[model samples]
Target: MNLPNQLTEREPIDPKLAVGSSLPNPKGLLAIVLALYLVNEEKDHLDYSDKSGNTIILKPSLITSLKAFFNGITGYNATEIDSLASANPLVEMQIEPLQVPLQLFWKIAKINILGTDSSSGERTGGVRFPKELFFTTNMDILKNVISNENGDITNTGKELIYSWLTNNNTPTSSVNIEQKLTKTLSVFSEETLFKTWNNSTEIIFQQEGIYNAFDTTNATVDIGGTKEIKGTLRNLKSSISKDIHPYLKISSSNVELKNPSLATQFDNYQKRVSNYLDLNPKSIEIKIVETEEEINVDDVTILNKIYYGAPGTGKSHKVNELLKGKEERTERVTFHPEYDYASFIGGFKPITEVDAESGKEEIKYKFVPQTFTNIYVDAWNNKDNEYYLVIEEINRGNCAEIFGDIFQLLDRNSDYSITPSNELKQYLVKELTSVDGIKGIENGKMKLPSNLNILATMNTSDQSLFPMDSAFKRRWDWEYIPINYEKSEENPSSHYQVVVSDSISFSWLEFIEKVNTIIKENPNLGMDKCIGNYFIKAKDNSITLEEFINKAIFYLWNDVFKDEDDHIFEENTFYEDFFPIATKGKEKVLKILEKIGLNTPEKED
Candidate 1:
């Protein structure tokens, strides 16, 4: 139950080695050294003098062995290799023997890049130790054994071991092991570590894993000899930082709480650390002003903001502008009528898996994650960066059905924290508990981190498609993008002329203004039916007759006026100008314009 001394102790071992011994030698010797280090006892320090006449010098220390092993295997200097291992947020220190060594080997098989045969492309039947033992690196031993002859160690047993370590594939400088080690460390984040731990379900440090088991200040040794969390959080922090087991098994009944509860508390502490890493403001203070006034602050924290406007009103454009210049994680998804909980969050899906015993393939259902689950986990990991999830056309889908139990996550207290339902709590714990380097879960609940912002864009016209209840709307701060026909004029480079046949060429800006005004003034055609200037953008500053007819005209006919009576347009000109191809030209369009008294030829000049 005691936290390992490795978590709380570091010794300065000033290692001195023989001159001219730093150059790259064969990897076989390095593997033997590493194998010896992994299988050594607590007091045992590796020494090259034990192997008679061997000039290589290795000091026994985790950091020293890691440095020498990496330097020798990949020709990188010890300093550079040391940095590579330390760069990861989580560093797995002790390789404990819980199950049999062979079973443990298979447990880490996915992460093990070693132990392959090269020339024949097969697994080498190396030495397989029968029993599970601490500090042992599981692998087949070399067939060649070094013999002590004439007071000197002879034979290439170390070289054979190195070949076994690298799966018999001698790594060249072009395809070296250093790059593979770097990649493994880079991809090895906290979440993945927790996932591996959860998968392994084995203790990282046993009672005898380290020295000075009883000598600790941050934690207390209970009667049953298990270490318990003291009032302070220093021990938990140290344990997690060194990748020591968070909760140790205890036999004492005097402990204030059980190991499971202590683990949960430790997890919550990790979540706060994750929050602090992102530099996001943890608190938000809102003051109600007595009068109408604008308040500006040097620091802004936008948690959940939604934009609503008519179609083509530049809602998405505004979102991009808001996120500009920020080094953040951003994901976008659109909600439609068919969008469901399984697609938004995650749900079980059927897949085929080979049965280990039967050696036959069988169908099984596993939880497949979608957009929300991915962003949720990412937000926890990259806490130092802002994470934005943009939901475009949120109102188009049934929000009630999509959020399901997760709807409760939207209800933040004054402190901007959320308490999840029991169902959601169980689900989150089950799915995310073992994720390495992840933090911020508490009592089976989580709050949307201050850095994780949910931005949604809703077309006001599509309100009828899926009505968002008052409860849902209340959770989000809404920003309205007003319809402005002259918006194109704000950026003259985007302005264009709409042409229909030979005699009809007019400014698209003026056409939109005129059409929108008519639609607004007509009681039957309300504001919802009014056109936004960006509905049909000009191609090369000139909108062709065909382009305008297909995009703008089609939308007006099908989306806007479909519910309106035909008499809304003067002399049924709307239908005639767009109906028959023979009459759907400049002459017919001009006649309709004249009928509506909108034909202003001088406007183009």
Candidate 2:
């Protein structure tokens, strides 16, 4: 066969070839091993039935030894011939075709001494053994060596079997032979021997006939193809062993051993099988190709945006929705009054460490990275994936002091860069050196990658706490989340009702509309002082009398209408009078609602 130059050209063979009726029954490592042994013993001329119409029979002694062998390996007794025969072929046609791949594995492991070529016009012929065979003559010794008292092969027995199989031509340890055979057999069972196809019998026979052709000199000419095959087989074995390890019925009674060499072999073999059983190679490869395609697509637009609104207007919720599935790519930090450059960027912080020479615990100042530096390095390292840095309550912190020299990075379009301190320069060199598309770090200057997005949320009510200057404010695109009064599924607060009493309740949105109108009409308090739709979320869609007075009524009396000559509350009514303990406190709130045209005796539906 003239193989293609690229390994990708050799698409995986039809999956049916690995699972169809042509393959052996009870497919497993044990079944394949036993089948190979039987094929070798029978010299490819084994009969499945006698003239009396009974199946091929075994001697009682041989049957008992086989049962012991099966029990030793699987911890399960063979109560009938069918259990043993399931692994063995039942017809001459089935028996003859298995030798091609079986002998190929043996040949790969340099143990092809028991069989001779039997060419019957097939691409790969069946094995025909010599009249007297060393393996057949010493069958009892082999069985005893494999199934000793401890149900494990001793080193001495392994050496004996190795020497017998290879005739000392390969100068290697017995462990090497064990690994070679185990790996080759695993690949044979998963990749070649068990494959099936829904083709004509002639086509299936032709495909099976060529199993050994890959071992020929012509196939070896495409060295790249050979290496690719070997790599895929290794990955296949690893994937299968991992999938099957959890379900393997390993026990002290079975042939699986605790010895390091055998245990390692078993551990390696245990990692594969489950995925191979249900594998659709084409679909799996397509997913991988799709991932690569996604990486090459256009990068997401970089954002330096701020979401600002009155308290409880879902400013934070807006940012969360935009970053729903990109959690791994996002980092969030809430800015407070105490936040500064050291906390926002990288700095030398005291960390506990063990002294290498003294073997004692001590404190050391290391360049510890905060959210900004951490996400900055990650964004440059993984340029294909979008990264985010979210700052909550941005106006709560003094941005000028918190950003320091790094504030220049907010102007992403500029080619400007910042020179780090000596400690930070060394850290940046270690992290950003040799990273593609990142420049000037080695020269002690650094700039942000285009894939990094900086998002912040601000409460308009707190704008006076630490007002951001014009330079800092101009760099970010600002968005305002207005109060949503529409009583729809999207507006959770629209369904809320302030429970004034058992017989009197009013829509929370209606109360806000009335109170906001009064606040807007007052010259001292306008839109900024208007109550937000979500100023207080209701529990079970009901805001209790206590919560309503403590939160809503208190804020309106103290903050919004405290200095206004015209207000919504009754004359001489103070904030304390709205408390539950005040005389007729609930009645006073009901009267205020009636004054605002919201005291209709109706409950939420």
TM-score of each: 0.48, 0.50
Runs in model 2 deviating more than 4 A are 1-302, 437-442, 581-583, 602-605
TM-score of 1: 0.48
Give model 2's TM-score versus the native structure: 0.50
lDDT of each residue in 414-470, candidate 2, tens digit only = 788889888877777787643553563746788877668898998877889998889
RMSD, every candidate, angstroms: 19.9, 22.4
Pick by TM-score: which candidate is best? 2
lDDT of each: 0.46, 0.54
Tens digit per residue, CA lDDT, model 1, 22-122: 11121322243334444342222233211112111222364565544444443334554344232211111111111111111112111111232111111
